[model samples]
Target chain A: MLYLEWVSFLGLLGCGLWIFLKLPIEASQGFPQKIMYLHVPSVITTYLAFFVVFIFSIAYLWKRELVFDQIAKASAEVGLVFCALVLLTGAIWGKPTWGTYWVWDARLTTTLLLFLIFMGYFLLRMSVNDRDKEARLASVLGIIGFLDIPIIHKSVEWWRTLHQPSTLFKVESGQASPSISPELYYPLVASIIVMLVFYIYLLLLRYQTEKRTDRLNQLLADTQD
Target chain B: MKTRTKFVIGGAIIFAVLTALSVQGLQEMTVFFYTPQEVLASPGKFENKTIRIGALVQKGSVEWNAQAIQLSFNITEDGKKFIPVYYAGVKPDLFREGQGVVVEGKMQGPRFEAHQLLVKHSEEYTVETENKKNKEDYYKSIQAQ
Candidate 1:
């Protein structure tokens, strides 16, 4: 697993660099639009990570298995990192495009709320001493936090926001169509694939570390007895 | 009932209630931005409600007073339907005639009283040759004037 992770990581880095240097600059956004390749993929990966957390949280609660809990915790941690990257790249893009670094638009506000809710989930875990109780509470929070995903996805359509609607999945006049030009679409797809593979690699590494920690704790508990 | 069954049912109930509330909130909170044609077509429906309208700035319609900090322009769609806008605020640097803009304000009779104005710019990068020619032409036009 470690060997595979390093190989994929190197491949992702190479692909990312190639796309950055070779992709054609958009006519309107010029250089700033390049941030989209990073920003969009980060947000997509964040959503995927949270979805993993949601599923594993439900599994943990249903089966009362420590492995499921470990996976949920690991995914949440990774999701939070990607969510923060989304915000950072978004802010960088916003400064040049919108003439402001931030706005209280519905989409932006909901995304921030999503980030905060997960932060609360982590805080709740740290405050609890009992392992089972902590898992139960965090799983519940994780399930509730997943609700924000749909809200964030539809915020642009649901409210008047400074943020533009999705370019890839445009639903204008009740018709869904992709609006991206071919020149921009291919590189974006490549970037998203690279980011997603990297996300999976990180998730596997985090899960392995979590399993090791759990084993160490069990050994220590047995020795104390 | 078993605790596991209870938790599953309770989680489902909470999820349902939250989804319902979100749908209700979205209905009330959604303020759709309209074009000039849409607003003009249904003037009575949007009266006094804060709404956003986007269109191209009509050429030669801009009136900016730096000292008074007042800006006014006519926004047009299809170059036929025009909505006059009056705004008292700091205009964005990109505010110019023949550019796309979206203004948020309430409609008062035939005019839009704007609270905020956002300049909508394209994502395309200007080519170097075009940029140089534009600069030269701008200077030449100013000298001619």
Candidate 2:
């Protein structure tokens, strides 16, 4: 985990440099548009993390495995942080491009809903006293949350939309136009890889911490008995 | 296999399907943001294409009809770069001279017409500081000339 942190730190530095220097050159015409790289990728990573939470939640419900339950909880927490980042960065980027921090577009609305749902998921986990019931309820919410992510993603295309279309990976929009130059892409990829590594590392730590806490609680119960 | 294993397998399949579906969905939406200079440089792409252009309003460029239903201005990346903008809707409170804005619409001949205009302003103040800077910059250029 420490190593992952180190890698992520370096990655952040690399990405910062790319964002400041190389991005402006590649996207000479669209200076402010470079925020798409950071914003879009973070959203993608958040979605993937939440998907993990959803999958593990289902697994926990079916198997009733403690490990699966912990995974769900861990991923959901990380997913929430990334989701928050996506919104924050998005709003910042919006200021330059959309002229306002907030809008009532379909995509924006769905994203806010997703953020609230996950926040509620965390709330439910905390309120329930019994661990089993907590996991069960949270898992159900997690599975439901997965359903919303797609709807959030598709809202732009499905309806008359105001939000900008996708930028990074577009098959139908034709070839991959380098919004940012290769100088930036290399660092951007590095940051993503490092973020992924950091995510795995954090999940491991969270699972271990949960396991230790469970052991301690069980021991306490035994002593009382 | 036990019930738990069965559940795990089912979950994995669903996960795979959902991931694939989401990836597929990403294909449909590809949005781009253009600045005023970019739109001016390659005018062809925006002739009838819906595009978003971000820039600061040029001084003395805003014009309004008698009824005030329609307004027009030139947006510039800096003082030197400019793109003509035409909007036929109610502008936001923040739409004014030397204000940062992102106008969304298609290019109508020499003018980049806007259907929806979003006034991009800082939360605290939406004043025209760029005017002072541009004034100084203009004087410096005039001196050089």
Candidate 3:
């Protein structure tokens, strides 16, 4: 299963790279617009990962299952990584376009808050000693942290921000129209798919590692007893 | 009430309060960037408020004094309604006439006191095919049209 996952990951990554390179350079942004392929995909995947964390967290709270908690932890860890990548890519793109590396615009501020919330979630998880109590607390935080996602999504529209409003999904008109050209749009979609697959693969690997650690702890306790 | 019911109600109340607070904050904090026409139509509303306006720089309106680091330009949305903008800073490399720009500042009567000027670069990457025409000739052609 692991081997197959790795092979498919490489295949999807190869496909994504091909599509990304083939995307036409934007007339105004020129080649710098290519960063959008990476930036957009990472953010989308980060949202997906966080959503997984939310679902698993709720499941853990409802069923009180260790497996659900494991899943939530794994997904949140992966989400945090992707969240950092999103910020990194965004800052890199902003420097050339917005003339500033960082701004306190609504979108940027909300995203930073999201990153900090997850960081706090991880810190809380590590600080707690009791397994069940830790899972319960983390579950609550995981659910609340997701509240930032909608705020982040709407920030560009809600505030006076330098960040451009939604280009892929314009909500006001109730239409799913993209503002970008088809050449750029297709590659962006391709990159999102590739990143989603990569996220799921990482989540599974991390979940397996968590299960192994739990089993090892059980074995050690049994030996001591 | 049962413990689960109590918990649910408490969570709902907290969520509602947070949502309300955020909604209120967003309404008060959101400063929408206005076009030149929008600013002109309601100039009284924007007085003393830090806001951003985006428009095309009017041709032949750009004046830069390098010694004082002062740049002045007129921006317009429809070429009929123009707003004079003054800034004292190193201008962006992309600043040019007929280019889209968004300036953040407060309105002082007829002139905008811009604290920051951002050049709105185009997203398209078309190859430059009309490089032979000089800057003045290009400006003249634009004006002639």
* Preferred candidate (TM-score higher): 1 or 2: 1
Could you give the candidate ranking by DockQ, starting with the highest? 3, 1, 2
**What local lDDT score does residue B78 receive in model 2, on the 0 to 100 scale?**
54
lDDT of 3 by residue, B50-119 (tens): 9888777888999999999999999986778899999988888667777767798999999999999886
Root-mean-square deviation (CA) per prediction:
7.4, 11.9, 6.0
lDDT for residue A47 in candidate 3, whole number 0-100: 88
A1-225 per-residue lDDT for model 3 (tens digits): 577488657867786677555656565556667788788888998888899889999999889999999999999999999999899999998877767677665778789889999999999989998778789889988999987998888776555566766677754367676656676777677778877887878888899999998899789888999
> Which regions of candidate 1 deviate over 4 angstroms?
A171-177, B1-29, B32-56, B59-71, B76-81, B86-100, B104-115, B120-145
Report lDDT per candidate: 0.79, 0.69, 0.78
**Per-residue lDDT value at B84 in model 2:** 83
Q: Tens digits of per-residue lDDT for model 2 on B8-105? A: 67768876896688556544332324666667888886688887766677899989774869988898865797888899887665466766666788
The candidate 1 chain B region of ten consecutive residues with least summed lDDT is: B136-145
Best candidate according to DockQ? 3
iRMSD values, candidates in order: 11.0, 15.1, 8.1
Decide which is better by DockQ, 1 or 2: 1
TM-score of candidate 1 to 2 decimals: 0.76
